[model samples]
Target: MISEPFANKKTWVHSLDPRLRVCTAFFLSCLFAITNQPVLAACALIASALLLGCSRPPLSALLRRLAGVNLFILFLWCSVPFFTPGTPIAKFGPLTCTQEGLDLVWLVTLKANAITLLLIACIGTMSASLLGHALQALRLPDKFVYLLLFTYRSLFVLADEWQRLQTALRLRGFVAGTNLHTYRTVGYLFGLTLTRSLDRAQRIHQAMLLRGFTGRFPAFVLLRFQRHDFLFAILTALFLIFLLFFWNNPFFP
Candidate 1:
């Protein structure tokens, strides 16, 4: 139930201009994607971790976010080593892993960790509503921005509905086991969840129409680029330039 864990923190990251944060994230992501060097990726990941530390969100929240990132990364570790061809490093039964494949795994894991940390540190500080407005200001597609906005709000609503369905099942003495009854009941729950989601979406659309929600969503609080934002921009630019330098340098081999 700890949704949007970083949003409420009274940190300098939270005080940054949402638009600036979004742009920084975009650029950092580009840097991650463009670089093939695992050393550079590892450096970026470390920097991202330090940045996240500065944000000062609760330790539990930090761990939770990292756990989610690593879970997906676990799949990459599992598959990349076996398939990518190079000199064999080790073998498990008949499957052989190569050094090149292991390198690829490192590249993926580092880049993903770097991006996730940066996203949590930068974008996670802002509320979904503010982020939507920021995205609109950045001239991202309206449909995508609105989708992000609605998805953020609706996630909690749908989760609540799911909990209610679980409660209803529990009241009817539903016990989860590997059986036909359990499978049927689980399927029913899924169908009901989908049905409720569709119904809610329809109602939400109608409500928006009634409230004069056109294609454009207006921001109540106008975002201004402040002194701190300027400072952040300067520092971020310097760091990115350093990353560029490192990429071209034959330091780590």
Candidate 2:
């Protein structure tokens, strides 16, 4: 099973309607993505951090996720500074670091972190099944929702099949190494896994058809918008308005 550390939490964030969380995360990400001003990005980042704090995610897990995001940002820092055209601030032999490049990368870093934190707080606190249901409730395309739910289910099946294959290989005294035989064995293992997955998929489809599945899975728990949800919506609206106001008129250089 996929580990969902944040999903089972009883925090206020987890209690909010999944649809509301999804919409909030989407709009916040869009707002953060298009903004080029560092001050606006910084403010957004601070807001996202507060949201994440409300979600009360495990600090260790949050740190791990942030580390992964920053690794990619680190790559951007390495390449973007040298190639962007602007007034040169620093030089290393033929490569020159420009002020514009540094500013651009910094804005990106802030936006990326802010959006990531926001998503982790909002979307990450729900199970994949709940997310799919929320998307369906939000009137997303039926095909897209079906694809997401199916893909998520299929990942577990694939992982199980792969693990069974690995166990078989281990039982047969297979030892991995930097050798042609190991490479061939690994390739054959992947081919067998694919073949088995295809067969399993066919079987599953036939079973679903036998059960009269008409492409729509019913949600067991109906989503209700409570007073808290209304309050959340109001607060989020005010926050967005504040961001917009500051976005146009920054108080700092």
Off by over 4 Å in 1: 75-79, 88-97
Error of 2 at 79 (Å): 1.9
Clashing pairs in 2: none
TM-score of each: 0.88, 0.95
Candidate 1 C-alpha lDDT tens digits along 1-253: 3378888888778888999999999999889877899888988999899888888888897888889989988998898899988999899987999999999888888998899999988888888888899999989999999888888777877887799999999998889999998999999999898889879889989998999988787788689999999999999999999888887787864
lDDT of candidate 1 at residue 47, scale 0 to 100: 88
Indicate the residue-level lDDT of 96 in model 2. 100
Q: After superposition, how far is residue 39 of candidate 1 from its true place, in Å?
A: 2.7
Residue 187 lDDT in candidate 1: 94
